[model samples]
Target chain A: MTFTHQSGTAPASTEASVPYLRLRAVTKQYPTGGGVAGVDLTVAKGDMLVLLGPSGCGKTTLLRTLAGLLQPDSGAIELDGQDLVSVPTFRRNISMVFQTWALFPTMTVRDNVAFGLKMRHVGKQDRNERVARALELVGLTEFADRLPRQLSGGQQQRVAVARAIVVEPRLILMDEPLSSLDHRIRVQLRAQLKDLQRGLGLTGVYVTHDHTEALALGDRIAVMDAGRIVELGRPVDVFARPTRRYTAEFLGLANVVDVSADGGGYRTAAGARIPDDVIAGRSDVVAVALRPDCVRLSQTDDGGTPGVVRVVEYQPGGVLHDVELTGGARLQALTPVGLSYSIDTPVFVTPEWSKAVPLAD
Target chain B: MGRERVRYPAFAICFTLLLLVPLVVVVATAVNPGAYIKFPPDGFTLDWFTTAVETPRFQSSLLLSLRIAVIASVVGLALTIPTAVAITRGRRRLRPWVSTATVLPLITPDMLLALGLLIMLVQIGMASSLIGLVLGHVLIGMPLAVQVLVAALSGVDENVEQAAQTLGASRATAFVRVTLPAILPAIGSAAVFLFIFSFDNVSISLFLSAPGQTTLPITMFQYLEYNSDPTVSAMSTILIVLSLVVAVVLSRLGGLSHLAGSPTRRSS
Candidate 1:
């Protein structure tokens, strides 16, 4: 597997540059056998690194460990050149926004936001000013005096953000913070969270299962599977050129075709000749994966390999056709919404050669 | 709908009347002008009420009962809150056993428990003393306190306390500022329940109380065995009124319905 740098952004700084937060060999093993396994991650100052994975993939475990809520069995977590593994949660100088919003229902929004300041012995006047500013940042100034239970779900989440940001800790950790909101509200809050992080120059580690959210929010994305990170790179790089079969399939970009060397050229399992440039410098290429978006379909069987349309799925702006080759292998291709084809329609499928990614196994 | 409404009210009235008739009779007997305990008083008089108050035996017993109840409830709370927290937040494997141990007293026969406690106290040379009486009451009241507290703690979101810790509050401070207030209503109800159970208890008090440490209920039971005066009626009425005050206060604080897991009604 190889990575194509489509986004043209430089990679994260190496350890010689003194990253703001550094985690080395963090490992926490649960009795049930699926926990964080020897994870090493680093985040530069004012950058957001998103831990993206499906549920039970140890993404939350990693975030919680960073927040000091869970102790790694053996690891060194350092922030600003200070080791924090032995520090208790309260003294870690970190803030977390929970998925459930976790606001104190008994206290009004103002009190909830001021709780951290009060604990740190911040003066009353200064605490009030900070709380007011935090609330305004989240657009929740008018709901300050109301109890958390009295607010809507989105409003409660905003109050949670205000409470987290008011403390102004060294780092902020968010665990699927927008997972509980409706899609529309989630999109709105996502933008707000991104802007807030950038405006304040906050260093953060966000965890989520949504790829779209990761792409939109992360300066770098770490895609985890099982208990370890399978791929880590810029969002576009990871999405377009996943380094492993699991990463490719997990990111919904797998259209793997078994190929073999036939005489001087490569042919798929269905005996269709693969263009030479697509298999360029590889003598040991056994299979290739193409993204669905990179495959094109035409109604006439004159341009490329011929297949029958098996299923047509309607997406928001386009449609996907599952085309079955004569060799009994199926592949999906995307087409414009104006083009509608019934199942069993004979069509030709062509994979854009430049976008074909070679697979190892 | 109209017929159903009328039928509901009718049933409620009948049920309420059945409960109120005996209490009315007791109050009527207390106010009787005659010395003997008779309903439909010959004339209204304050003699029985005054007599019940003036009696030295009743006075000391009332003080003893109040002291015992307060001590028992406080001790019960001290023992049960940690137990409830452990049961709620500890390992999943131990939860079932912890729950059973806390609720054991509710199903065990009081006489059996009292007998065991009496023997234990006697062996320890603390029988028939204030300490022995309080110990017994605490045992009986602990189950009630633990049950209510466990319910309240389970309803609380654990993340709120974690959030507090990340906000610079220590573990102890987080619990005091977040978990404690969240379960305050349940604690209030449990205290009231422990107090009432200890104050009105007779069977456990029977084995635990010495000659001078007799509680109000034990004293009243002994008095009723010997005399037929209206003094006991007056004492019962006073106890009933005290309990009513506690109930009203508890309801005003919205503790009762909260313990039952119902949404509390707001008074306009």
Candidate 2:
């Protein structure tokens, strides 16, 4: 049987063209002074928006407020144009997958998945059917009668996912749900979660500090710091063209250089002049951020800025040459792993002009 | 390792003997063929046990004690579960004061508490009634109930409750379905503890019981004051055996360590 709404209202359509979830000027201040401050975000139906940040950045606060676990000091939360800030959490029709699986230890896997349906007083037949379907979706059908402690970490997390989605909530909030798992399981579950969200066309907000996760799973990434979204855009766009210094440094491995305007060009603090074409049309560019992968290294000191390699570290994919420029600016360049470069070796570094991002002071 | 292996057995034997000797003497006296409560019984017989069970006063007092213990412990649990939940889930600033207040009765001298309750009950005109006795027992039993329930509730992760609320369960439903089941073992252990405490109490029962409503412990005390019979020894032996049975049953159900906030043991 198709999943039906127990409340007699039509299930929210994944095809609805409007933003399914919106938070406007949401502010919740802790007494000790750092909480979410004026966070404004919108999640369109069927889209996944990742809130990416470090610890203490209030991403979790924003997620909790969206989940109605926290009441914002001042803000309006609307889902499908209904005011959600005033709604009690149980009536919000939003589900969350926590960092810790939070599966009820006393309940079996099937019962855990059926909890939301039981809360809504669905018939036992339908509840069992839906629970079976959800467990099948998460590939935990054989473990239905087993308690949470009987499952491995990944399986427990899968149970958590099944529990969240079995409710068919209008919006799903995940607070670093994959953060606790080991690396391989995290990667596997990340792919599964992304596919599941898209296949069901469920709009979701995912929070994480891991850059690879943000880039891999988010349709759009909102880079946050100090309780504010510093950058918001498509993942590739945000990664390639971060407008803020914080975003450029936080979202990618970047070499940030302090530069000054030099007659229609840019000059580093160490007095190396960067060509006009590399400055990217920003006359006010006080600095340029280059990704380590974008800088090319050559031994002949031709057609680029000359620098001495202070450290040559070997990585699996490539070698990293920590280069100190002639005038004392330092940068890293990625080269082939087998190319031998000892410490104190001289090399010339050239920035790929298209990859240089101009930043405001 | 060698020293520890030898020392641990020695300590175990000494400790076991320390606890077993008094109980052994009581049992020996209860089985003594001669009358006069002598240890290292003159010979074995079940006459004192039969005598302790057959006496009308002993029978009535034992039944009264059981009734009071069951009723008072059930009421104590009812009063303390909600209070414990509130104190644990309430404001951070209020927790310490509330906790200290809940446990105040446990630290107070039993004589002082009983005297205070007697005066209060008399002024309220409930003195010497069974209701007054149960109320007094509840006051004394509440601390144990609160301590056990509070530890159990604290062991529960708050996120699971929040998760339930987000899953469309009202606050009350979440508590009953999730929070309550998570701590049920602790609650059972607490009720048993309160029952035993109320059953064994003498001071509060001494002050609260009226004529014909004497509890078993108070009756035993009064009997020992004037009599040299082994019946009191027989009663003590029965009480000890009852406590041991309760302990064994509780362990079989689920151990009491979970009430002390160890992680809940899952039966896989």
Candidate 3:
């Protein structure tokens, strides 16, 4: 089987001019518990790489390693070419925003944002200027004198972001900073964070479990699983053509169809023969997978499998209608906005051959 | 069958009666006009109060006890806070053992610990003195402080400290800036408990107090043994009042009872 990058896909941009930080085969093991496995990553200056995975996947550990909070048991970390493996977290010239917002309860917002500058012994005039700029960036200037407890959760999170950036460190790390916010606040802050990252040209390593956030915020996204980075590429590429079966399944729920090797191409479980030209065997498993959006419904006479609509869910963006075919295999179809469809309607479900790729476990 | 009610009023009345007996006797003895102890006074006067305050021995012993208690508690807090933080900050494997070791002092018999300390001090040529007494008080005070600090540290959001570290604060700085403030209420409660333990320490002081370094409890014990007079009652009244004042101060500082009343003093 041959592998191919689909046509009309946008080519990834050239590498960033200056490499801000590089984690060379970094591996962290707890001796008593599992931690991040071998991780090879290069975060360029002004680049944002979001580590996306579920809990216990070690995305947080990778971010912490970058911030020098937790030292990698193996491999070297180079910051702007100089090895920072042994450098302490405080001296790493890196800042991090935690999931908890971590604003200093004793200090007002001003002080919390100014703490990094103070620790670095920044002059008072310059410190004030940077602190004010950061607070203004986060739209928290009015709450500068308020203690952290006095601010709302979103406001506190913004302050945490402001505090990390106030010192204008070369790199910033955020571990699910918006995960604790309400849905509305999360949506609002996501746009704000993207705007801030662009405005400041900040190099950031953001760890998150949400794919939407990862796709929206990260220039390059790394999907991790079981302590290892299973897939890493541009957000679009990772989403559109995942390298591993795990990657395809994790990005979104892809309907996986097991196929057996036939004389020329392959045969679906239902004994339907598929030609070789369609199955781009990228993985070892003899299964073809397609996104729900790829599965289309039409009249049975129009070269589609006979099926009955089992369930119809009207989502905000589209209607997700599941079709149970005569062969007993279920397929889901995403009918876009303004599409007319109803439950229990007899329909024909056909998989989009162009996007279906062979899957592996 | 429905559960039987607790009869809270009966319990409250019994508790009040039990506590009122001592308070009433102490007040009556202090006000009695008689020079000696009596159940019922001929008349009321404040002579014993005046006499108790004027006594140089009582005044000196009180001052010495206050000084020892203050020093001991301060030292004990210094030891406990770091250990508590260490316990809270340690790996999962180490956390349990460290927490258990810190609280072991509270579980062990105070008399046995005091005897052991006295023997150790004597072996080191540190005889009964203010320093030895202070050390003994710290031994008794430390468990209370640790218990309080551990509870306080446990209540502190670990994420806050981790956030601090992310925001350019070192572990120590993060603790001082974030963890300490969050746990200040617990620390305040701990301080009150250590103060009480140190101020009223009898078993440790009995073994450790020097001739001139006698603490208030030691002096009170001596006076009670020698003569069951109204003066002792006056002293007890003063102690009760002092304890009440401290309790109020602590409550104002941090709602100490709320913290102390928790079943899990040191959260795992």
Model 3 has a DockQ score of 0.35
TM-score quality measure for candidate 1: 0.91
Which stretches of candidate 2 lie above 4 Å from their native place?
A1-17, A262-265, A277-286, A300-313, A324-329, A343-354, B1-9, B253-255, B264-268
TM-score of 3: 0.89
Model 1: how far residue B86 lies from native, Å? 1.4
TM-scores, in order shown? 0.91, 0.92, 0.89
Interface Cα RMSD of candidate 1 = 4.7
lDDT of each: 0.85, 0.86, 0.79
In the predicted model 3, the residue pairs found to clash are none
Q: Give lDDT tens digits, candidate 1, residues A97-132.
A: 999878886899999999999999999999898889
Candidate 3, B1-268: lDDT as tens digits: 1235766788899998998887888878788887788877778888888888887878999998888878877777787788887776777789888777767777889899889988998999896867788887777777667766776666666766766665667888877877787777767766777778889989988888887778888888888888866887788888888888987877665544444644222212
Tens-digit lDDT string for candidate 2 (A1-361): 2433232233243343577788899999899877889989887877889999999999999999999999999989999889999999999989999998688878999989999999989999989989998898899999999988789889999999999999999889999999989999999999999878877777799999999999888888998899888888888888887777788777657888778877767777766677677776776676778888788888985788888999988877688889998778789888887675789988888877566778764
Q: How many clashes show up per model?
A: 0, 0, 0
Error (Å) of candidate 2 at residue A201 is 0.9
Give every prediction's interface RMSD: 4.7, 2.5, 5.5
lDDT of 1 by residue, B1-268 (tens): 0113434578898999999899889988999888799978888888888899999989999999999999999988888889989998999899989899988987999999899999999999999889999989988888877887887888788898999999999989999999888888888878887888899888899998987788999899999999999999999999889988998977765555555764321111
CAPRI tier for the interface of model 2: medium
lDDT measured at residue A158 in model 3 versus the true structure, 0 to 100: 95
